[model samples]
Target: MSTIDHPNTEATSAEARVTSDPVLVSDVVRSDRLLLADNTVKNHVIAATGVSLVPVPLLDLAAIMGIQVDLMHELCKLYDVPFKEKLVRSLLTSLAGAAGTVVAMATLTSLAKTVPMLGSVAGAAGLSATAAAVTYATGRVFIQHFEGGGSLSDFDPVQFKELFKAKIKEGAQVVKSFKPKSTTNTDQTAQTV
Candidate 1:
C-alpha cells in the first residue's frame, strides 16, 4: 500500500481559517467593489457638474437628468440590479422632492445668469458646485442601498429621504473643498504624441 503525504498543514490551516469566515471574505469583496463603484460615481458626478454649468435654467435641468440617469444605470450594473429605464426615471422623480433644496438653489442661481456679467459668473460657479453635490448625494444614496443588498426593485426613496439630505450636506462640503487633480499622464502623453 502506498502512503499519501500531506504537506504544510499550517499553511492549509491558515487558508482554511480564511475560507471559513464568510463575513471577512464578503467584506473584502465589498470593499473592492466599493472602490470601483466610487470611481464610476465620481466620473459621472464630474460630467453632471460640467453639463449643469450651462447657465440656462430649464436646459441645465434637462441635461442633468440625462447625466443622473446614466449615473444610476451604471450604479445598477455595478450592483447587479436590473436596470429599468422607466423605473429609474420614476425613482428619480421621487427623489426630486428630497433634492428640492439643491434643485431650488440651482434654479435661482441659473436665473441670476440672465442678468449677465457678474451674474453669469456666479451662476456658473454655483451651478457647477451644486450640480456636483447633488450628483454625489444621489450616487451615495444608491450605493448605500446596493451595499445593503437592496436592488432597485426594493429601493424606497422615502426610507432614505433623510439620509439623502444629510449626504447632500456632506457632498456640498466635499465639492467646495475638492481641488481638481491634473491629468498629468494624459497631458504628457499628448505632448509626446
Candidate 2:
C-alpha cells in the first residue's frame, strides 16, 4: 500500500476530499458548524475569565452572567434558534441552579472579594477559573443541544445535569490552554465584530 507523505496536513479538507455526495456534503457542513461553534465558545469563555477579574464582589459574577447570556445569544443565532432574551435568562438560571456546587463555588469566589485587602486577590484567583469553567460548559451543552436538533424553547437543564458537570471538568483544562489576549487587540476585535 502507498501512503501520501504528511497525511495529517491540511492539503485535504472535508469539502475538498469529498465529491458532490449529499451525505458527505452534509457531514462537511455539520463539521464546519461544530468548528465554528467551538470557536465561539472559546472566545466567550476567555472573555468571561477576564470579566471575573473585575475586582468587585458579586459585580464580577453579574458581568460574567451577562457574558454567558451573550454567548448563548450568539449560539442561538448560529443555530437559527429563536433568540428571546427573557427565555434565555430563565434557561440560564435553570442551568446554573442545576450546576449547584459549581454555581455555589462561583458565588463564594465572588464573595471572597469583599475582604479589605486580600479579597480581591482571592476572588480574582477563584472566580476566573470558575467563570471560565461554567461559561464553557454552558456553551458546550448548548452546542450539543443544537446539534441534536434541540432548541432553547425545549431545552431541559435537568436532562443535561450530568453532562454539564462533566463538561466543567473539561472546561478547566480548556481555560488553562487559553492565553489572555491583550486589551488593544480585544478592543479592535470587538469593534470589528
Candidate 3:
C-alpha cells in the first residue's frame, strides 16, 4: 500500500477554521419586524379591553418569547458563530428576573381574563410594552456578543445582564415612540384599464 502524506490537517482547530459569513442589517430588520408584529397584535388585543381575549394575547406573548430565542440562534448562525443550543438555557437562567417578569405578566393576563371585573382593565398595555422591550434587549445582546467575536460557547449571560438592561430601557423608549404604518390614499393612483 502506498501512503501519501497530507500537510497540517490536524493543526487547524474547528474554531479557527470557522469564518464569518456576511450578516446583513436587513436580515436583522426583518427579524425585528416579526417581533414587533407579535407585540403589536398582543397590545392591540389588550388595548381592546376584552376579557375573553386577554388569555389569547398572553399565550401569544409566551410563544413570541420562544421565537425570539430561536431568532438569536439564527442570528448567531448568520454571523458565523457556533450555534450552542444550550446557550438559550443559560441566557434564561442569567436573565431570570427579566424572564420571570414576563412570565408573571403572562400569568396575570391569564388570571385577568377569568376574573369578572379585572378583564376590563387596561393592564395588558404594560405587558405588551414588556414584550417589546425584552425582545429588543435579547436581540441587542446577541448581536453585540456576536459582533465582538464571541461565540455561543463564550457567551456569559451574567456579564451581559447590565448591558441588556440598558438596552431594554432604550428599547422601551423605542417601543413608546413606535408609530404604526400609515395608509396611503389610493384614489390618486392612475388606472391602467
Candidate 4:
C-alpha cells in the first residue's frame, strides 16, 4: 500500500501549511463588540460623572470586558436574531436618525412659516443639527443599552416600585457610608475646668 501526502497533514517542503481555529476566531470577534461597548460606557461615565462601578481600583479590561460580554450574550439570548447586538444597534441608529430628522424638519418648517427672515437658514441648520444629534444620540443609546444590560428600558423604570426600590437601595448605601465612628481614647490631663 502507498500513502499519499495530505495537504491537511504535513505536505511537501515546497508549501507552508496554514491553520485556523474558527471557534476561537468567532469568539474573539463576538467579544470585540462587547469590549467596545464596555469601554464606551466607562469612558462616557468617567467623563460625565467621574464615577466608576468597575470592581478594580482601576478601570481594567477584565471587569469592563466581562460585563459587556455577559450583557451581549444575554441580549443575544433574549433577542430572536442570530446576531443580536449588531442588528439591534443598527436598528437603533436608523430609527433615532429618522425620528430626529422628522422632529427637526417639523419644528423648522413651523418656525420658517412664522418667521419671515430666518426661513431658509433655519431649514438648513435644522437638517444639519438633526443629523448630528441623531448620530450622537444613537451612539449614546447603544453604549447605554450594553452598559445597562438587556434594554435601555431596564434602566428606565415605567413602574414606581422599581424606581422606589432603586432609590431605597441608593439611600441605604449612602447612609451606611455616612455612619459615624466613635473614638474611645479619653485624656484627663487636657481637661482644664
Say which candidate scores most in TM-score.
2
Error of 4 at 47 (Å): 29
Question: Of the candidates numbered 2 and 4, which has the greater lDDT value?
Answer: 2
Model 2 misplaced stretches (Cα beyond 4 Å): 1-23, 179-193
Give all TM-scores, in the order shown. Answer: 0.78, 0.80, 0.56, 0.28
Give candidate 3 regions above 4 Å deviation: 1-58, 98-110, 116-123, 180-193
Candidate 2 at residue 153, lDDT? Answer: 85
TM-score of 2: 0.80
- The sequence of per-residue lDDT tens digits that candidate 1 reaches over residues 1-193 is 2223556666788899988956777788899889988998789878877875675666887788888899999999888999998998888878767778777887887777887789888887788888788888889999999999998889898898899889888888877667666677888999999
List clash counts for every candidate, in order. 0, 0, 0, 0
What does candidate 4's lDDT look like per residue over 102-173, in tens digits? 444534443443344455455434433332232233334444444444443343323222333333334334
Candidate 4 C-alpha error for residue 136, in Å: 3.5
lDDT tens digits by residue: candidate 2, 1-193:
2236657555556556774455767788889889989999999988988987787788998898899999988999889999999999998889988979998999998898888678888888889999999999999999999999999889999999999989999999888877565578788899999
Ranking by TM-score: 2, 1, 3, 4
**Whole-structure CA lDDT of model 4:** 0.39
Give the winner by TM-score: 1 or 4.
Answer: 1
**Residue pairs in candidate 1 whose N, alpha carbon or C atoms collide under 3 angstroms:** none
Residue 112's lDDT in candidate 3 = 58
| RMSD after CA superposition, every candidate | 6.7, 11.2, 12.7, 19.0
